[model samples]
Target: MIFVETQYDQTPAALNDLVENAALAALKHQSAPENATVTIVLTDDEQMHSLNLDYLGVDAPTDVLSFPSEEIDPETGDPYLGDILISVPRAANQAESTGHDVESEAQLLTVHGILHLMGHDHAEPEEKERMWQAQAEILTKLGLGNIQVRES
Candidate 1:
């Protein structure tokens, strides 16, 4: 299951669908289990700043953050992938700078976060190449081939 919670009041209604589709695309690309579940949280910069500081020791706000979990829900027996938090304001800014709409940027971030939850990382050169390639392929499948993820 894919769950989305919007803590930001200004988020558009269509954003929820975008996030869900992006997540599903990423999961399908990764060949995740059919019963896997994940949550996506759309929030503001203030909450993102606090989360970044508390969890990653980074004092600055970020566009997206993913916390991976490998737990199974006892009741449903679904694999809980984890939670993804995205700053709506940050995504808007990034979208403005990248010459795309907020919807596309949010979807990009969604895909990026799901990739992370699926154990894709860019800490090393080779890892980054692989992850980026996978991300691009997923984005293309989502009809966002022209939307490039900005370097952070």
Candidate 2:
């Protein structure tokens, strides 16, 4: 099981659990190395905006950002994926915009974040297709059909 830490005070209890479940499910579906570890830090949009500007050269806050630490470990066979940081307030706004519950939207973003940790990206057409399909399957299996994953 993966451990998730949140810096936001308003983050709901169920939100963390949903994120964990999504991470576990994504790891299993991706066939990642056993016991692969990563950390997730949830914060408000203001913090996320600063992080985005500092790390990604963007001025706006994003839903999630993934920083891959050890894609391939030489010492250990287990591949340490990466760290995922999500904005709780942004997620809440997205949930409202996408017509889904807060928990479901957060879980979707969590799944998307875990996919990035596994080296899945959506910058190109083929890559986006594969990543989105994987996310859709994982979300569907996790009972997230009502929540849509738009190709943005």
| Best model per TM-score | 1
- Clash-forming residue pairs, model 2: none
Q: Can you give the lDDT of residue 117 in candidate 1?
A: 98
Clash totals, every prediction = 0, 0
Which parts of model 1 are misplaced by more than 4 Å?
A: none
Model 2 C-alpha lDDT per residue in residues 1-152, reported as the tens digit of each score: 47799899999888888898889999899988777987888888888889899998999988898888776557766666788888998888888988888899888888999988888899999999999999999999899976788853
Measured over all alpha carbons after superposition, the RMSD of each candidate to the real structure, in angstroms, is: 0.7, 2.0
TM-score of each: 0.98, 0.92
- What is the per-residue lDDT of model 1 for residues 116-141, given as tens digits with 9 covering 90 to 100? 99999989889899889999999999
TM-score of 2: 0.92
Residue-level error in angstroms, candidate 2, position 48: 1.0
